[model samples]
Target chain A: MDTWFYIADLAGVAVFAIAGTLLAFRKQMDGFGVIVLASVTAVGGGTTRDLILDVPVFWLHDATYFAVIAAAAGVTILWLRLKAYIPLNRLLLADALGIAFFTVLGTEKALNTGVSPVVAIILGTMTAVFGGMLRDVLARDIPMVLKSELYATTCIAGAIIYVALSSWSQTVAMLAAMTVTLVMRFGAIRYGWSLTVFKEHK
Target chain B: MDTWFYIADLAGVAVFAIAGTLLAFRKQMDGFGVIVLASVTAVGGGTTRDLILDVPVFWLHDATYFAVIAAAAGVTILWLRLKAYIPLNRLLLADALGIAFFTVLGTEKALNTGVSPVVAIILGTMTAVFGGMLRDVLARDIPMVLKSELYATTCIAGAIIYVALSSWSQTVAMLAAMTVTLVMRFGAIRYGWSLTVFKEHK
Candidate 1:
């Protein structure tokens, strides 16, 4: 079980790091900037969650996360010539999977720490969304979590579902929650679904 | 001593909240957006520091910080009518004071936790600058700490001074460090001191 969890975690890190590196590339950032963005996008959400939960920061204790981010970043830089061949949809799918995995993991961690259901759901959503938000902010773009599709909303809904089903088997609840989050996100990406924009009235 | 610290902390919160609210107003964000910006700008740095130190989030345990932020935001909203009369320099001064106070306070807290001096100084600088960085990011502006002025450098220098002088009386060290930070920041504001911008080569 622990091995599976670690594998999922590393996969998420790699996906987010690639996304961040691509963004930095798009923004014409230098090599150092690309690495910084990749590292932050890979670990920022979990770091925020751990801080809020008063736990040891995940990346600080485990060097594997950093190694994964560095490896992903290297792959991204080396694949610069193949950028035109890389499908956007595939990136989106990887991002959705990462969000789903992180949401369940964060919600379960919060629940284990004895926080209220509401806070757990919120933290879970934050944990799933904040990394992307940080990446966008660093890249000088508006955070997609704040404006695009049903990103954060999907995480929140999945977290609430996970909490509500806590009386059932933990593994079953986790799987169910991850499925819901991924489906919602993928649906949004496929269908161009989005939350309403709040334009200011003049 | 504790009372004085609380007083200074609240003052810093009020100043940063007001600055955040005014920025939100300029960005034409709604009331909820204004409050969110204000709250994050006031407490974001210290909250970040506490999280890194693995300590209980300060605002979670105490309601006063939120109350102070609310009051400051309210005042800023009401003072919008008198915007032209509000001197920008005074706001800068308040911001300078906030950086000084937070730098010393964060450094002391990190030292209390037995972190190495270098880590303490870095954490202290983070505590001093991250709130403003968050505020700018939320307002969709590049962070001042990253781009302009001697802001974060002042905090770093002050934190180093505090740590180096730790063998001396804590009170004297704190006061001296705060004074140095304030002087450097005020000098920057008055003389238009700034770090060199890193323009990307075409």
Candidate 2:
């Protein structure tokens, strides 16, 4: 189970790096900018989580995450140089899978830190969504979480489910939470679902 | 000296909160959004620094910074409701003053953590510029540090000065560093100075 989780975490980092690189390509960012954005997208959320929990940053201690992010981003740039076409739809599906995995992973990590359940849930959601938010912001776009769609909502739901089921079985809880997240995100994308934004009147 | 530093830190928080609220007003963010941005702008950099330094977050330990930020943002909102005109120029000056102070403070804090000089300089610059970066990101604008002028550069220069002079006298070191930062920032604003952005060509 530990090995599986480790693999999933690395896979999630690669997917996120790829997603961030694609976005940077759209912005026509320089190579350095693309790499920076990709690295932030891959690790920003987890770093923030570790910081808030007052722990040493995972990447700094392990270094594997850095290696994966750089490799993923480099491959992405090279692939894009060879082929101009971007399969954004497939990337979105991969992103959904990544976020689901991250949601459960983040919740479990926060729970281990002895924070309250609600704080853990929020931290879990942050772990899943904050990286993408940082990516969008650096690209000078409004964060998808703050603007439209159920991006954060999906993470929040999955985190809540994980917390509720944790006393039963950790593996079952993780599986169920990820399934719920993936289902909701896929449904939103397939059905063109969106949350209504607040209207401000002067 | 500790009392004076605490007061200065609190004042910096208020100034940063006001600066953030003013920027949020330009984006026409709601009250809640205004407060959120203001708070992030006030503490984002320091929080990042503390997290990296593996220290308890200053605000989490003290809470005074939070109170100052809330009060500052609330006052700015009220002032704007009564007066439609924004003193953006003056606000820039105040921001310069705030960043200068924060640069020295952050450098000192990082040094106290026993990090190397280079890391201290980076952390200090992050402490001064990161909050504004977060504010710009949340507002869906390009971060000023990344986009235009010598924002981060000023902070960096100030941090370097602070680190260099630390072996001399802390009080003199702070004043000299702050003066350098203020001069650079004020010059950049007054003379319309900017760094040449790297152009990417396909």
True contacts kept of each: 0.13, 0.19
**CA displacement after TM-score superposition, residue B126 of candidate 2 (Å):** 1.9
Specify the poorest-scoring 10-residue window by lDDT in model 1 chain B: B79-88
Candidate 2 vs. true structure, TM-score: 0.61
Query: What clash pairs does model 2 have?
Result: none
- A27 in model 1: Cα distance from truth in Å? 3.5
Candidate 1's C-alpha runs over 4 A off are A28-35, A51-54, A70-80, A87-90, A187-199, B1-39, B51-54, B59-129, B142-202
lDDT of 1 by residue, B87-112 (tens): 66766776788889899888988898
Q: In order, what DockQ does each candidate have?
A: 0.12, 0.14
How does residue B54 of candidate 2 score in lDDT?
83
- Name the weakest run of 10 consecutive residues (lDDT summed) in model 1 chain A: A193-202
Q: What is the TM-score of each candidate against the true structure?
A: 0.61, 0.61
lDDT score of residue B2 within candidate 2: 78
